[model samples]
Each structure stands twice: as C-alpha cells, then as structure tokens.
Target: MTHPGKPLIEVVNLEKDYPAGAGVLQALRGVSLSIAEGEFVAIMGASGSGKSTFMNLLGCLDRPTRGSYHLDGQDVSRLSSDQLAALRNREIGFVFQGFNLLPKLSALDNVALPLMYAGTGREARRRQAQAVLERVGLGERSHHTPLQLSGGQQQRVAIARALVTHPRIIFADEPTGNLDSETSRQVMDFFSQLNREEGITLVLVTHEADIAAYARRRIRFQDGRVVEDVAQAEVAA
Candidate 1:
C-alpha cells in the first residue's frame, strides 16, 4: 500500500541476480514494497537473505536484473548511470557503517565534498557544512580529521556529510554498527529527531533488534523475500 500525498518509494517484483560459475546466483527474488515520505523503516534479515541486495537496488548503487523501482514516483529502473548519480546526489543521503570520510580532509571539507561536485561556491559550501556539523553536535570538531576523532564522533561527521546535501531521504546501512551501547542510543536519537523535525524519510538496515525497535515500521527478509511487514503497534502487541 502507498501513502497519501505521495509515496517516496515504490518497488514491484524487484529481483537481483549475479553471475555464478555457470548459472546465475539469485540475490533478491520478487520483492515488493512501498514507503511514504517521513516514514522511518528498519530492514532486517540474516546474511544472504537479500536485505543488502534490496538496499543496494533502492540506493541505485547496483541495478536489478529484473523488476521496476519507482523512487518519489519516478521510474528509476531505467535511468542512465550519469542520471542515477545525479539523482542520488540531489535526493538521497547515505550513512555507512564504516564512516567513509576522506582521510586527508578536515571534517568541514569532507562534508562539503558533495557540494563541490554540484558547483556550490566556496562560502556557501562552508556555511552549509558548518551548519550541518553544528546540527550533529560536532561544530567544535569541524577542523578535525577522521583519524583525530573518536569512532562515535567520526560517525557524526559522516551523518553531517549526509545531511549537508539537504537530501529528502537517508539510507543508512547499520548506522550504529561500530558504536557502544550509549553511543548507539545517541545516534538513534539523532535519527529520530531528524525524521520527526525535518520530515526526512529514513530507511536503515539494522540487525540489532533494539535498534530496529526505533523504527515505526519493521520489515524482515528471508530467502530474498519479505517475511514480515508490520507497524510498531502491531509488533508490540
């Protein structure tokens, strides 16, 4: 079912396959779902269940072998590589488990990197990056490099980088995978705040049940298909 106003994501018969030694290796098989704007969703699965594959397809990092994917009502299943890159840059922000910051750049520069490709002026980029860094509670650490920061702080920098582009949707792959329990709580809180306050759609892949608890909707995958899709109230009941 799609949401009112407009669905931020809609997928149908989504499938993905890879080349095996001779035959094909099916990664995802006939998965379909929809997500609304401002919805927070948690995707869960055991390894090889195709949760990761589904996410890759949604993020446009990889193409599906078959099936259609509509993002924000646009059929993105057939966009060119350059078009996909541009669309991703303008509409989606990504938070990785490994905090993929450029090692040589300062936090500000790293956050500003996406804007440079968009041809943003130096001052505007600086202003936007600093604002997001401050929003993530790392304004004081803006001058530090990834190596110079704590793991939790580095993750915040990565989140700031994701937000600096002013994306409407965020795809976070295990956003708290490397943090301590307390730090993970903090990060999850930040995610909830962004979704509530800014109306940003968030879809995150997380294996931890407690982390998944934060999402309003939870989806589980098994053998490359959705095993469960339920709302938080129903799940609690």
Candidate 2:
C-alpha cells in the first residue's frame, strides 16, 4: 500500500526532443504523471510511442529537454550530472531485459558491485548481497558465474543486484522479455511479492498485456503523450 501522502515520483510538463537533419523530433510532449510510494505502475506503448524515452527520463539515465522531474521530492531537473549519478545510485534500482551481468564475476560479486561503488565496506556489501540473493531465491547459486546459470537464475541475480542497494524505486524495462513463459511468470510473481511485502515502488515498461496486467496501474502512451491511465480494477471488468 502507498503511504499516506508522499509521492515517490512526480513529473510536470515533461518534454524531450531531438534535432533531426531537417527538423526536430519530439519523443515526449508535455507529459505529466505522479507515482506514489509502493505503487506498481506499468508503462505500455507501441513502437516509437516514447515509452522508452519516458523511462530514460524517469530513471535519471537522461535529462528532459524541457520541464521538471521530482524524484522522491528532490528536483532532478536541477541536478548536475554528478549529482544525478549520486541520486541514481542512492534512490533508483534498474532491471533491464538483458541480464547485464559481468561474465567474469560470480553472482555474489555482481550483486555486490553497486554497494562497492557506493563505498560500502567489503564485508557489509557481501553480507547485504548475500541476503538479497537469498531473498530472490538465488542463495544456492551465489558463487556461480552468469554463463553457468539458467536465464531465470541470471535474471534473479540481476534483480538481487538491483535490490541490494535498497533503492527507493525499481525501474524494470521489459524484465521478462527474454525469459520463457514459465520463467516470465516466475519473475513477475517475484516482482509482485516484492511490491506487496517490501513496499518497493515498481515501474515496469512492457509491450505485453499479460506483463502489464501484473502491475496495479497502467499508463498507455501514443504520439509521445499519455492516452490512458487506468487502474487494474477498471481493466479487469
């Protein structure tokens, strides 16, 4: 459940545009939305509909060309690159479609990487990483390298890595895109469990209806703008 009053993410009149050879292409135009703490929100759109661009902005991976973004009440638009990096490290966790794990590193090491970068002590990082891996049901595979793990296990490690930092929000872009149907179901179930049990705000981007259905709220985009925002209760019947 969301907290009484605080919003985890807020966007106001957000816009992003790129200059082409002959003209400018707008990826997002005057989009505004807010996500409260512990909300599981899904963003859905067709190709070139600007969902990816919006996710980039929301994740602090890119800046908006116009307007403002407040993440956990901090004005992200006003932050410098260094400050943005710090904020990202401190507040955001990312799970991508591809399990971008280091081939040479063991699952535990991969999970510990973020905390290590945050200047955490080695022992503490290892302990936290191990706890997260166990939480994600990957404790038995902690020492295995990516190549040695199944796709689902690898993705679990990726999720463990993301959660080890104890982020305020988790941004998952097609997290189940590469998994088999059963694995996808498993992963989605884990996401649901995390949201319900841990109160982590989840933002998922996907093209699949079934995947989007896992989220409590859905937002659809078209021509660089939100065309619909519906609660799952409304969608079910």
Candidate 3:
C-alpha cells in the first residue's frame, strides 16, 4: 500500500546557472515542485527548457545554485558532495537512456555493484541482485554481458540495478530514448508496475508525448520555468 501524506521530494525556489562565454545562462529559474510518495510524475520540455537541469537536481547529481531542496524530509541543499553521494546511494535510484551497464561485466555483477559499494556482503548482494533481476524479468539473462543482450534486455538489467538498493524513489531520464516504440512501452509498463505494486515513487524525464503518457501527472517546462502542471485526465484526451 502507498504511504499516505509522505512528501518524498520538495524543491523550493530552486535555480541553476551556467557560466557562458560572456554571460551567465540561467537553466532553472526558481522552480518549485513537490512530489508525494508513490506518485508517478513526468517532467517534459524541449531541448533548452531546463528539464534536464531539473532531472539533475531531482536525482541528486547536482545541487541547485540557490534555494533549498528537501528529499525525504532531509535538507539536501546544504550537504557536501560526499554526504550527498551517501544520501543518493541510500535514497535515489537512477535509470538513464543508455542503460549505463558495464560492458564487460555480467548483468548480475552490474546489478550487484551498488550493494558492494554500500559494503553489503557478497552473498547477500548476489541474492538481492538476483531478486531484483527477476522482478525486472531478466533473471534468465543475469549471466549475460551488456554486449550479449538485446536493447530491451539491457534496459531491464539496468532497471534491476537501480531497484536492487530498494530506494525511496527512482529517477529515469529519457529511459526509452534508445529503444523502439514497443520496447519503450514494455519498459514503461514495468515502471508503472513498480510504482503501483512496490509503492516506489517514479519521476521520469521525457520529451516524447507517448512516453510521458504513462505517468499520472505531467509538468511542462519552458524557458527555464514550468508553464503547465496537468493531471492525466487533462492531457490524456
């Protein structure tokens, strides 16, 4: 069952800027958003709309330039890099467009890497990795390397790796960018199942309309700000 009234993510007056040749480019303009526990949301925008910056912030890959970010009731804006890394390892799971699987390692090893980094015992890590791989429908492919699997299978392995740690939330950035429509649908279905069954919050970043459709809510960004926040009923028809 989904946890009630738990605010998994909260961003207040967040901003990000980059130093250009002669001027500073503002990527995020004081954007604020709140994501509840077990909610499935998608952030959508064009190439320069700051959605990518938002994703980086949401995944704890980068800190905001100004303002505060609270993740799971902890103030994350003030954390040091190492501290943030530790928090990310324990709280956030990431799925990327390219799968990001180690080319030479088997799927099981790749999935077990995070557990190893967290100092879990070898046998325990293997067991947890195997369980997650099975959940993602890749248990039979656990012995295969990235080069040995199809695109969809590789993505499933990546998803398994992300879930093995049992994070509070999963952040997926253009996760289906490299897959065909059918494969993309399969991956999205798997994500939906995770959210509904396991009560894991899912935040997806995508530019594709069909891909975003799978999310319960959609936030649209433009020129470094959110222009629209719509529920599924508002945009689905």
Best by TM-score: 1
Looking at model 2, the pairs that clash are none
Question: Between candidates 1 and 3, which one is better according to TM-score?
Answer: 1
Q: Which of the two, 1 or 2, has more TM-score?
A: 1
lDDT tens digits by residue: candidate 2, 8-51? 89999999998988999999999998999988899999989999
Candidate 3 residue-wise lDDT, 1-237, digit = tens: 232457889999999999998999999999987889989899999999999999898888998999889998888888899888887787889999999999999999999998987889999999999999998888898999999999999999989988888998999999999999899988998898888788999999999998899888899999999998877831322
- Per residue, candidate 1 scores C-alpha lDDT tens digits across 65-162 of 88899998888978999889987788989999999999999999999999997789999999999999999999999999999999999999999998
TM-score of 2: 0.95
Where model 2 places Cα greater than 4 Å from the true spot, the runs are 1-5, 234-237
The whole-model lDDT of each prediction reads 0.90, 0.91, 0.89
Candidate 2 global CA lDDT score: 0.91
Clashes of each: 0, 0, 0
Model 3 regions more than 4 Å off: 1-4, 234-237
- Minimum summed lDDT over a 10-residue window in model 1 is located at 228-237
Candidate 3 Cα RMSD after full superposition onto the native fold (Å): 2.6
Error of 3 at 52 (Å): 0.7
